[model samples]
Target: MTQQIRRVLVRSFEDIVIERVPAPVAQDDELLVRTTVVGVCGSDTHAAAGHHPFIDLPYRPGHEAVGVVVATGRGVGDFAPGDRVIVEPNLYCGRCPQCRSGRYNICQELKVFGCQTPGALADLFTIPARRVHRVPDGMTDLQAVLVEPLATPVHAVAKAGDLTGRTVAVLGAGPIGLLTVVAARHAGAARIAVTELLESKRARALRLGADVALPAGAPDLVDRAHEALGGPVDVVFDCVARGQSMAQATDMVAKGGHIVVVGVGAAGTTPVRLDLVQDREIRIEGTLMYTAEDYRTAMSLIASGAVDTAELVTATFPLEDAAMAFSASLDLEQVKVLVTADGAVGVDGR
Candidate 1:
């Protein structure tokens, strides 16, 4: 008889529940990973509420995860049993032109592991060997879980070119927004401002390195961001990506500035003032998931003590309590919520 294990599934926001299924075995060129920790992302919550454009309903929900290898299949020699790893989650068709051009994040057949397919929110899950990165020797599960999330902002900051002494505004002080502050600061941004609805998140953004954190609903937000950064921002990392935030971005960014859309916006048209975009020559770019190089940069930053892992994770629930974890992730005061498997607690890899 096959062994049974539990995994969380989301049919809707009010319908998240744990379900048991047979444990999976590694296939060729794959590794079976036993999940240790999984971070609940803003996109996960959006998908649960049926708001995400790419992610559909009734799916396993774990993308940002840390795990240990339980088994390796044929052709997998890079990792062994007991090796710790972080899931990269972005799946791409190697034959795609985007993949051939070293931009597989936008591969024509690109599919995210947790979003478009089954993911690692279980006792055992098999993934392609190329999709998992070996965790550094002394990095804790808490820190490792952040690699996937941080890689995004790392990639976004790269799109903005060198930040050395550049002024930046990150709209939204959630996990991505707060991490954008960290990434921008690390890239040598001269000053950084953030806007969010919750005071707690604004405060957390300040602790994470923002020079100014303001209310997202402020009518004068564009001016406030300009004044806080000493002038119009040279780069605006729109972590909110809403119609209103895009408007604010266009208003606050200086002439010839760059606006990197880091957040996943809703599916539909969002109006943009093309006149302003044309007159000011603002460059608007959209960033997706990270590449292997960005993943390496994220790991290096985490290993170098650049990220405050403690400040980012607000709570953790057992694998059985994934529903509660998702609920906590939606809490206004929470920064990052995690779900952990048995024996994964207190073993911080310190």
Candidate 2:
């Protein structure tokens, strides 16, 4: 008899339902993890609503998750039944030029689990053994599950070189922005300020250690930010993923300041001001997904109590309520909304 597993998914764009999916047989060096918690991302809202490029009709939409190993394939020695882990979710083709150079997340042939394959909204998931990371000491699965997104900002901060005693400004107080603030602080920025239009998000950004949080496009935004920083900032992290914010931020940064764009932008639209970037020696670079080292750094930060992944989670719901959960995310219901595979977990329960 073919094994079956239940998955909370949409049969069609509008048909949300629980599906009896065929249980996947793991290959050697893979581990089958019984799903625990999966964080619903804002991009998941686009993919779930049929707007993402990689997703098509009817799919499970979770990428950041933590679970317990239920089974191990042949040759899988690092994990066995009952080991808790965080999922890396990225599957990069290692032979690509980007991969060989240690920038695998940009491999032209990259395939993300939720975007290109089965995701974490189901009863179980099979992933390469190396992609499963042990939950660090004293960190619960709930906190460990956020390693993916946290690592994103970690990689961006890495690209910024050194932040010791430098002023950093993060544009946008979304999930990535909020997380970036934490990482920037932990990376040694003397003062960090964030900009956002949403009042609630701005407030949350402040609570997360931002020296100040304010609206992004104010007439004197640059001057105001400098005043808040006690002078011009040395780095700007743009998580807004929009052309306007990018354009505005270019000038907000100091002459030699570095600006890193971690958010993906609309296709065919370039957000850079080439002349200014070159003439002023202002460095602006595009950052893709995190590297393996980025993940390691994220784990260390979590273990050291530097970044607060738990505080970033603002809402939760059952897996079967994925559609509603995604809708809530699209409506900005919270900083981060997670669709939990285990329904018995209360809103704030560990």
Candidate 3:
């Protein structure tokens, strides 16, 4: 008899269902994992609502996840059954020019799990061994699930070069934006200010070490940020990629400073102030997923207590209630929602 596992599937826009499917088999270079905790991301919400550009309907929508290795294929040696690990969702072909140049995150033929491929929102899944990073002993599965999302901000911050003693501004205090605050704080930034529309998120930003949390719609938002930073911010991370936010980012950045685009918006194109960018010589860069080193650093930060992800988890639902979990994630009051498999809760009862 074939093994059967429960998984979440998006049948149509706003219609999510749970179904039992055959468990996948581990290939020669793959690891069979039992999904532990899967975090609901904004992209997942978009995909469910038929807003995501790349993800098609009837998709399994989860990318940020941590699991336990249940079995390893013939060529696998490092990981064994029962080892906890975080899954890197990006899959790339090693022969691509981008991969050859050591930038696999933006590979010529890149496919993201949960978007372009089957996701880990299931009881069992198979992934390449190279994409599985071991979870440290002290880190809980709740915290481990954050490693995948946090790696993105780690990579974004690294793209801005050295941030030591620099004043930073993060626009939009979503998961990525909030994590960026932790990353900048760990990188020795002198001050960090976050702009968000939700009061709860603003407060969370402060709790996460942001020096100041300002409302995104403040009439003098740029002026207030300048005053808070003692001048124009040295770096601006536009975590809300809408046109208005991008415009605000261009205006708030200090001359010759850097602006990193980290968010994804539904709009196909947003008008930017190119004249301002050209005149001030401001550096604008876009970051995709993350590299292997970024994942390592993210795990190290979580394990070493440099970043606390537990506070970000607002709610958790059993795997059977994945649809409800996804619904809760859309609320502004919630930061992150998780779906856990059976026996995933621990002594702490999380």
Model 3 Cα lDDT, one tens digit per residue, 73-170: 98887789999988998999999889998999999889988778888888888899988788888888887998998999999999999999999999
Residue-wise lDDT of candidate 2 within 1-350, one digit each (tens)?
56677676755446767767677667899998888888877567666666665667677666898888888899987687888888887888889898899888888898888777878788788898877688887887667877888999999999999899999999998888998998999999999999988888888888888999978868888889989998767999989768888887787788888889887665566657888888879988889778778989989887787666556887888777776776677766377888777523222212
Best model per TM-score: 1
User: Would you give me the overall lDDT of model 1?
Assistant: 0.91
Best by lDDT: 1
- Candidate 2: which pairs clash? none
The superposed Cα distance between candidate 3 and the true structure at residue 151, in angstroms, equals: 0.4
What digit string (tens of lDDT, one per residue) describes model 1 on residues 1-350?
55777778899989998777777789999998999999999989999999999889988989998999988999997689999999999999989889999999999999998889888777678899999999999999999999999999999999899999999999998899989898899999999999999998999999889998999999988888888888899999999998999999999999999999999998999999999999999999999999999999999999999899878999999998888998898888998899998633121111
Q: Which RMSD values do the candidates have, in order?
A: 3.7, 4.0, 3.7
Candidate 1 deviant stretches above 4 angstroms: 343-350
Per-residue lDDT of 316 in model 3: 93
Q: Model 1 residue 140 lDDT?
A: 95
Ranking by TM-score: 1, 3, 2
Residue 124's C-alpha lDDT in candidate 2?
A: 82
Candidate 3, 239: how far from true, in Å? Answer: 0.8
Which clashing pairs does model 1 show?
A: none
